[model samples]
Target: MAGEKRDFNTAAATWDQKTHRVRMANNVAQAILGALRPGPDTDVLELGSGTGLVTLALQPHVGSVTAIDSSPGMLAELEKKIAAQGITNVRTRCVDLEKDDLPGPFDLAASSMTFHHIRDTDRLIGRIFGILKPGGKIAIADLDSDEGRFHESNEGVFHFGFDRYLMRKSFEAAGFVSVRNRTAAIVTKPGPDGGVRTFTLFLMTGEKPARETEGQ
Candidate 1:
């Protein structure tokens, strides 16, 4: 949450007005569902859950969700959605996961298109590992390096995208096992040049070793 953090507070009002963003979130949510298969017993921790597009979608399938974002504006919008829908399983928190510690022995820690804003992927992954319960799963959906064209401005963006192989390495370095990645979704948008370009969103999942069986 540094280096020209996007004004998510200001952007929160119109965040869901864009059709492309909604569609992309739906696609990412489906990818999470397919990978994790969250049930009523599952407690989910969502990182960078701006506006709850993916958060609300996944809420019905899981036991409970703690959606964390750096911007209170975004969480406010998410709260509105939760209230409007009369959903009780979802909650929102405004915090910078990059600098703060979250209390969650979550069954799954997941995010969509949030990794690029983080400065240190390895550190964030390791932090996630610490908060998850034994055998908890991690799933992330993010862009493949596009040379910083994924947004209108790259002011707050850390990594334009990520190398899938290296991302897996980071997970493994965090002591997560059974790590794997897949093409979660593809988003086509207008580039800065006014030309249509497609970007890859990958879903990477891994498991923290259970206490009883390390790396089992």
Candidate 2:
């Protein structure tokens, strides 16, 4: 996790800016949030909320949201945005996912542009499943593939993104059903030296079965 702590703070500062990179990332995030069929009673939990971008996007749709992230700086920015927007329904918490237990039984759980940062995919999925209520849904939006050499050079293991097929299987193994992966185009401009890149991200979604079938 080379500079993992630094990258998020930088992102939090420029989160509201309309740069191409920011726009692309937020687009994917927004798409993931949009997929959840939120209700008036829906209690949503968002993992890795940066600067309240996704939290603000989802607030109007759900009953309430508890946004969690590991970065204190990011959470500070989220607090500022929450106050400015006068959004009282959204609560921000700084939590270390690798160490802390996710609090829930939430009607739905969602993460955007965060899960790829985690290396232990199975444990992460299992934790999410543990907190979800029966028939609850989990939606994750992240890079489809982690193949860039830069990531390898920077972080020991860049997670290689997520495999759609493997993601579905993991969710199924965790007792979710109606699992599927939805792809959408995410446009990013070139850095100071590199060319522009357009990434196709997948929003993998699954639901916990209301009840197990007979004869299992």
Candidate 3:
């Protein structure tokens, strides 16, 4: 975990310079927005909000956002962007999603491209379930399973990508219902061998069942 944080921190200064990264973030945010259709009263909690690209995109549609990331350097860049844009609805925290407790009971929880970094998806999904309010939704955008070519090196990656079926099963195990998954975007990047590689990004969503009332 320490090594992964260090790598991300080192990449923070130049993270936004990659056009593909920005485009992927935008596409992910769009997918989540379309699925969740957040209202002015929605309270969102974002996991792994590196550099706040999605956070900024989401702020306009929601009442408030609590963005969490493990990398301090990434959060620093996000804070800078938030200040520059005068975005008052978003707040940030540097905390590990795996080891730390999240602040929540949020109407929505979302994440993009960061799940592959975590070692345990099932446990994380359960944690997310606990933090959301009843009937809350979770929207996650991440890469589909690939032949391990996307990341040139797998130093920090826990899952090369994810299988949609397994992901949905995990969501169900975590007690989410009305689950749906679909392709959200496709990204082409230059491979190490000078070939173009296409990676598919998927959007998966599920909703926590609302609490039961005394009378039917």
Candidate 4:
């Protein structure tokens, strides 16, 4: 969390071996599908899509997916999976979505467990708004407000979870409408005290409203 560097590259090879992590991704994907009910015409852009856990889960439901992340190692692993499975619609990009220009105009944008690593949440949301088609939607799954104890070490964590009400405000500030959230998953991990701690995952969804036409 604070002192150590959490390298997804170093962890990529064995990432899917972690059963709980995989389960968490599946849960997040299910929650997103429940909220979005995307169609075959939906083009998806996923941010911080580590190893394509959530990306692959949602790939079958969408027209296409461009999964982006900052870790080359993680992307490599994802590439392996796509190649092995002959996945034709999902592609990967290794870049910082917060600063880089990506090919988009997507119908949906989604992420799982990646929001806490971002420092400027509102800016990213606004950027997504700009990249998305009007009436496009976003589904982000993350931990609820926790007092900095979710991670064992603070690698690149920017927030110790988030407040749903305030997060809805951020969505609105980015011109998103019909914002809503619900508990998506419950995970238990060994806390710093060596005991099991339960953490709640939330799936937050919102839609970008169609812009108004110029006044007549």
Whole-model lDDT values for every prediction: 0.89, 0.76, 0.90, 0.89
Query: Which number leads on lDDT?
Result: 3
Q: After superposition, how far is residue 171 of candidate 2 from its true place, in Å?
A: 1.1
Residue 80 C-alpha lDDT in model 3? 94
- Residue by residue across 45-142, what tens digits does model 1's lDDT show? 99999999998889889999999999999999999989888999998888797888886889999999888988888999999999999989999999
Model 3: per-residue Cα lDDT over 29-109, one tens digit each: 889899879989999999999999898889999999999999999999999988888889999999898899988889999
Model 2 local distance difference test score:
0.76
Better of 1 and 2 by TM-score: 1
TM-score, cand. 2 vs. native = 0.87
lDDT string for model 4 (23-48, tens) is 99999999988899997899999999
* Best first by lDDT, ranked: 3, 1, 4, 2
The positional error of residue 103 in candidate 1, measured at the CA in angstroms, is 1.9
lDDT of 2 by residue, 143-208 (tens): 777465224244524365778988889988888888977874464545445765556678888998
Please identify model 4 stretches exceeding 4 Å from their true place: 1-5, 213-216
RMSD of each: 2.0, 2.8, 2.5, 1.8
